[model samples]
Target: MPNRWLCLLLLPACISAVTLDCKHIRIDKKDFDLSALGGPKTIHQQRWLPPSISNTTFTIDLCNPLKKLKGIDSKEQCPSGTRVCGIEERYNPIDGVKEVTEVRPIAGEFSTSHGRAMDPEVTRLKESSNADQEGLRIELRGGKFPETRQGDLQKAIIELHCDAELTGNEGFEDDEAAVDVAGYGSMSKRAKDDKDDEDEDEPELPDLDKGKSLQFVSYKNEKDDVGVLRLTWKTKYACENAEKAPAKEPGNKSSGWGFFTWFFVVSFLLIAAYIIFGSWLNYTRYGARGMDLIPHSDMIRDLPYIAKEWVGGVADRMKSGGSRGGYSAV
Candidate 1:
């Protein structure tokens, strides 16, 4: 019972320690805040290889794990704590009949151990690599493919570039095309209607006021190298001047005056009022002159002398070095 309670108490702390903060990402000397693009973004692509057609779906979330959406199944989705995931389905004709040959996870963590250390591997792109390319590179590993020479752990690299106009929906229309080309057939009528209704209900610019959007640029599976997937993302958050906007609460209004500010302001006003009222009283009642009209006049007058004496005593102490423990010679 004691051990169970201890584990429960420590769970929250462990979770917090490993949580990745995508709002503040630093690479080399540059900083990026991608918190605006926190949700998952997905892309689908189809390639026509000689004997088979390959259809791949890639999903990434900068701030959280990819959730299992309505049409996606738990088995087809990546394991929990996965920030980036890719699944590939191959269709081939066997005995004059088209069939699904293979369905496998191409790029993403397969083990639950990823929750222990979930920080994404990020780095800056080399200047000499591409003159036109400038931004941070992120690497996600833990995929397994036995056919590759790069060992069991496959990897994916995503390059984030800065673009002011993209909203991460640039290539979403290609999903239908990919599905058609792969001969995977269309989605069910209910799903299609739901998606269309969602599109109609959504605002044209959902993230315009909050922050900029992320756009999918391209995806390339390195055939020669094998087990490597390269992707590019464009967003204003990846820019050098990107800054995380201050979050606003729904009903709360921002005010410059805080507790200490009000405290000091109130103190000054009260002191001023007291001084003015006291001075008037002294003048009308007793004809007090000069500094004597002030309240607490004696204490106020002695303040300068007190401060000067204090300074002098401190200086003397420093110069004399205080009495040592040794007694004077008799």
Candidate 2:
């Protein structure tokens, strides 16, 4: 049988194409009956980090006000001489304490949107809460980020998000609504072991300026949304200074052939062509493609009758469009 495969081989080049130049970001990072548009997807955020070259934002696991757990921290553990640190009359009061140990923040900045962070209402009631009768501990999870290198890096911001909508079917104005965090400054065991090997008299802190505490907040979106915040490492060069000129390399001319020379040559040719023959080129491209030279010996070798159809059909097709008829033999 004549092979059916020969007919299938030419099918792909005959199909029409669909263009995909459109783009979008879902509103509220939310899920709705967007099945009509592509998704009714759930987009819950679990933590926040800072952006590098641009604004950074992310989310933290929010504790629910109505839930509680017990036995995580006993009331007896609030030591008599423990130290404490907090804003003026702003944090929950630690009671029955003979002493309060002050907390030294590794880095901190107050956020208007992230108020009541160590929310006493949540911590006190969740008996299993990382919260103590003294204070609360918290959990962090669910990260999505592009991979990053672990190098001479001291502080890292691995993810970012914004316009957090955390109220869960509730509007933004509830007075009790707030978000909180609980985590310690962390490093690898290798890092800790390196520290253990060092001198006891002097402590090393990563230079704070390079890894500044970060906060980015915008209140402009909507009532149901928490104002967005981003995180970032401190930039060595301030934004205003990035536009200043690079310093001179100090020479009258470059040393050898470079891309600059190649670009100059190509650009010169294009301008010269536009002035000389661009209109002619635009009009004659099809005529040019149809005009190909076959050597006399090769032309003689083709089946003569099929060759006549090839040449005559292409010429007639060109002439129908009021263009040059392609070449043919007498």
Candidate 3:
């Protein structure tokens, strides 16, 4: 009897365990910014721009179209099981199609509007920044309203924040480092095998895997009564600096030494060879010894003496022509 009663009590829990169909909700990478000081950080269908502890506003844009709102076309409704959370439409005023800022939920079903309604989730949940606390702590809280009408849907968005601490490595890469939020699991997709372009001169980045994983944090369907989803991530600026390549030490010699050393050495050898060859030639011609062979042997040992005697004779014979600058050619 006790076992049967236990099974009967557990029947409702088993039946209500259907996973919330949140495959449609997607995070917009562009709307998310870690640099804001104290503004609406998360982006949702409804606009909420003020009254936050920090000026930073991380936005999550529901790229998925809405389904069941009061004034919207039925063709625009979200999937059947999902209820209406927020309506994002442009008001066609006389000026033109201006963006509607007012938060609109399913009419006559829920009174709450805007994103601040998520404060309760933040209050209920507690999260710490990374161990280093490298940046501002952005908290997230979310849940769903009871299904007053059939197919009532709950809308949720994720927020990422970096604290006042700024790591200079920010903006180094297009993709931000994956964040590991406590109790929230990892905020990045699992890695897959894809070729990386090593030719690009990109700086070292965190070893986060990039894959086509669904960008959701968590979701819970409350016994077909309400559905809740929550997601949080740290700002890219909060990531730790990647290890930089070590500085190269200067070489012992200058860059040109290899060519210059070989050139000088070869030049010296050639010059020594030329002198030795000339000396040998002079020795073979005149049979002179020692330094006499350095200059042409004929010029040093024979020509100077012969020229002196010849010049003395010529001077005596051609004094008159010499004085007139017309010496005889003989």
Best by lDDT: 1
Q: List model 3 lDDT by residue over 1-330, tens digit each.
A: 999999989966653332221221112221222222121122222221211001111123222222334665554333232222332333221222233232323211121332222221121112343443432222222323333345444544343344234322232233321122221122112111111433423222223223211123544454454444444443343332322211221222334558778999999999889889988888999897887778664566777789999999998877665465656567
Worst 10 residues of 2 by lDDT: 34-43
Model 1: how far residue 182 lies from native, Å? 9.2
TM-score of each: 0.48, 0.16, 0.22
RMSD, every candidate, angstroms: 21.1, 25.7, 31.6
lDDT of 2: 0.24
Mind giving the per-residue lDDT tens digits that candidate 1 earns over 277-310?
A: 9999998999999998998999998999999999
Clashes of each: 2, 24, 26
Q: Tell how far residue 157 is off in model 1, in angstroms.
A: 1.0
Ten-residue region with minimum lDDT total, candidate 1: 203-212
The true-versus-predicted C-alpha distance at residue 320 of model 3, in Å, is 89
Model 1: what TM-score? Answer: 0.48
lDDT of each: 0.58, 0.24, 0.35
Cα error, candidate 2, residue 220 (Å): 14
CA error at residue 62 for candidate 1, angstroms: 2.2
Please identify which of the two predictions, 1 or 2, would achieve the higher lDDT against the true structure. Answer: 1
Let me know the TM-score candidate 2 reaches against the reference structure.
Answer: 0.16
